[model samples]
Target: MSKISVTELNKISREIRQDILDMVYTAQSGHIGGSFSSTEIVTALYFSEMRHLDPADPKRADRDRFVLSKGHACPVWYASLCKLGYFEKYHLSSLRKINSILQGHPDMKSTPGIDCTTGSLGHGCAAATGMALEGLMAKDGRRVYSILGDGELNEGVVWETAMAAAKFKLDNLVFFVDKNNLQMDGTSDQIMPLFSIEDKFASFGWNVLTIDGHNMDQILESLKVARNTKGKPTCIVAETVKGKGVSFMEDVRNWHGKAPSKEEFESAMAELTA
Candidate 1:
């Protein structure tokens, strides 16, 4: 796919935010804060950075893979996939419904564009690392990408995967930490202080970059840098607002997994549309 201009990318991100709000409000239950937070990151990858992905051939072997390690934020992933024509747009309203392909968390078996079934927090990063390792062994030249919540960093398994990825020098892997600084409970600092995500990743022997997660240019540029770095996995620490683009929701912990009421939904849609 040809690269989309930053302006166009920003427009897509807004539309995605709208979709997230609509999906969660319609479902009356879904994660909105983290989904909104990671909107631009996921948008940039699906629209500009990833290679060998053909919506027509969702299972193409050479396609770059993306794992949403912070699976509650699957609304962002689902919105992007629907926009890219992975499945019918009608499924957006079916989010979290019984047997819906667009589940609360990702379900690879039912979703066309999902590369992995995730929702177990730190497990998805480990899965992405394994996929990167597999690609290296097979010499398929495929890259694996994943996004993890800063809150999820509390998982010891994430550190385990970090060590393993560095030990094997999995340069084909790139991970983004959605450092929104808020978890389901409270602020990251209040819940579990991760003093420096960048320093932590660097200490784990991975190449690390920190950027404004919501900035389209920084997001695209960081992905480029990740592609060029050699001999180690790359981690991009993206600083972002938890409930981005919505005034009432921004940085508000209650919005983490709560659906907007009709009034709240209207307010959010108006903000996003504006």
Candidate 2:
């Protein structure tokens, strides 16, 4: 209820994680691992780093913008938006349900507070780059942010978008790379090894920062640095475990998009609540 402190953010993170577990378990489908991995980043943005995210003015022009490039992890974004009052909390229960506005991926037209409808891996980058271009061209002070999964980085379009963001000196853009080593398949190294996620972005001429994605202080600090940066885009490559909070699920690739069974769900809830 007060200005959110780190303690409050941690508590909110746990609540959001529990909600994600419940949402995925009830729907019988949804990406919980990635959602859990992104918990602190999303919280730091909505509660601490981002500006003009007042849920009441969901579409305010010049407001800070965000896109979840890794759209399969919509559960975390949805939970944050709900907590921020962008939507009804009860809507969380419908995630991945047939005909639910809460679909398998984020839909800007369907969801409040979603800047871009990103389902395909690399498309979100293009969209976020476009939004940053729009803000820069208009000289609007608003900033644009997006999160890309490390696994999603395998797409060539991501590099293309990165180059475009740098070309225009779109310093208004900030990207958070959720560098969780495991994807829907097995380890990212086993599936598609990406050589130095930070180097790849730096090669594009964007400012780069790497941090432990789960660390509350580091996430907030990187966001502050990103906001102050100018002349090019900023990318925060965050190393995170796939399933961060639950003991059994941490870094487990199988949980990428699989709903937990009743027992696993209960166990996850207990850990998160604890």
Candidate 3:
């Protein structure tokens, strides 16, 4: 991974946001707000960190891996992978189309860089824990990174995985919670009140870090700290907005899984380009 300046990461983020908008608009059916919220975190992981897999050999055992536990937000991950040369940029427009590799949820068999097939919200964390444990058993330096939505934490499986992660002592795995504070129904608090996610993870016996999810420097530094942790998994609570960049989408639940209208798409693209 190249050392990227904050200015450069900011520029890259805009391109990713454009990809998110374009793909969702083209598919006419896909999650929009969550993808936007997660763009920077996915961009930072794929472009500025992670290593050891060529597009041709994404399934290699020694490669660093990433799982989109919040599978519905894969547009951001797909966009980042394309930008990182995992596949041609043109494939991004095929998102959610019939028989497209870019399915509504991530499928590792269909997509080259995806390491796991994840759509059921809380399952990715458990799968990620297993992958990280495999690396530990092999004594491989490879790390596993999994991104989870704050809303997804409402599932019991998330805490089960948290406990298992601590029990296994998976120092090589890093978990990121996209703490956007909203689920499909309403705000997270109204839904289930995950009052202090950071504290909850801390109680699980893992090292925890919190950061502004959109701040490239903080994202980078937290990953650095996580990389250096020993004997316990690390959890990063990334504070984020549901819809990060575009004016109309930010914090708006109506846009959760709705594609922007043609006019809205045009305005979004124009704003991002500016």
Candidate 4:
């Protein structure tokens, strides 16, 4: 597959950001901060890297899968699905509404293009590892890509899955940690210090790569190298701001799960478009 250029990827990222703002603003509930922070990473995956079947045929076993382990920051994933034509753009307005496909967390059954129902932090990666192991056992060539938050790494299960993936030599599994530094209550350091995520993954026997999560070129290059490497799983340490793009929201913990009001939404949109 041809690589998506930096210019094109940035364009898509901008659009995804807009979608996130629109969705959160409409629902009057959702996480916009982390969503913005992860916009570029998720955009590169869904639009440029991941290979899945038609959204309607989401259950097709042959398709590549993405599991959002840090599932609270799911607005980015939701935006990508909409942009990729998984569902109508209008449905995004109903996020978190009763009976809406856009739940507080992803539901594979309720939402097309969602691989697993994820919300409880630090669990999605373990499930993804199982899926990858299954693919290997079945002689299927699909890849499993999972994204976890830096804060979510506090959960021991993430490391357990990491260790398992390395032990199994599940090269088809690609994991990314959004190292935005901040969590819901406060910064990761204040909560639980993380010492060198790259080294941590490398020590676990993963083919580890570190890069700026917002840089399209770097993100794509790292992913390509990961895809080609054999005999071990790959983990990319993606450094990002807690809230990206909008100045006020950036790195603000309060925005972690808060929705913007009408006035705030308009102001944010103006900043994003600027």
Candidate 1 lDDT for residue 82? 96
Candidate 3 lDDT over 47-141, as tens digits, reads 77888757877777788889999999999888888887889988998998888889999988888788999999899988999999999999878
Minimal lDDT window, size 10, model 4: 50-59
| lDDT preference between candidates 1 and 4, better one | 1
| Pairwise lDDT winner, candidates 3 and 4 | 3
Runs of candidate 2 with Cα error greater than 4 angstroms are 1-3
Task: Summarize candidate 1's per-residue lDDT along 1-274 as a digit string, tens digits.
Answer: 5897999999999999999999999999999999999999999999999987788899888889999999999999999999999989999999999989998899999999999999988999999999999999999999999999999999999999999999999999999999999988889999999998888999999999999999999999999999999999999999999999999999999999999888999988999999
Would you list the clashing residue pairs of candidate 2?
Answer: none
Cα lDDT tens digits, model 2, 1-274, are 1346889899999999988998999899999999999999998888877778877887888888888999999999999899888888889899877777798999988888888998999999899899989988887788888999998999999999999999999999999999989987688898899989888899999999999999999988897788788798999999999999999999889989898999998888988888
Task: Return the top candidate by TM-score.
Answer: 1
Error of 1 at 12 (Å): 0.2
Candidate 3 residue pairs in clash (backbone atoms < 3 Å): none
Task: Give the per-residue Cα lDDT of candidate 4 at 270.
Answer: 92
Off by over 4 Å in 3: none
List, residue by residue over 175-214, the lDDT tens digit for candidate 4: 9889899988999999999989888899999999999999
lDDT for 30 in candidate 1 is: 95
Cα misplacement distance, residue 119 of candidate 1 (Å): 0.9
lDDT value, candidate 3, whole model: 0.90
lDDT of candidates 1 onward, in order: 0.95, 0.90, 0.90, 0.88
RMSD of each: 0.7, 1.4, 1.0, 1.2
- When sorted by TM-score, best at the front, the candidate numbers are 1, 3, 2, 4
Model 3 clash tally, residue pairs: 0
> How should the candidates be ordered by lDDT, best one leading?
1, 3, 2, 4
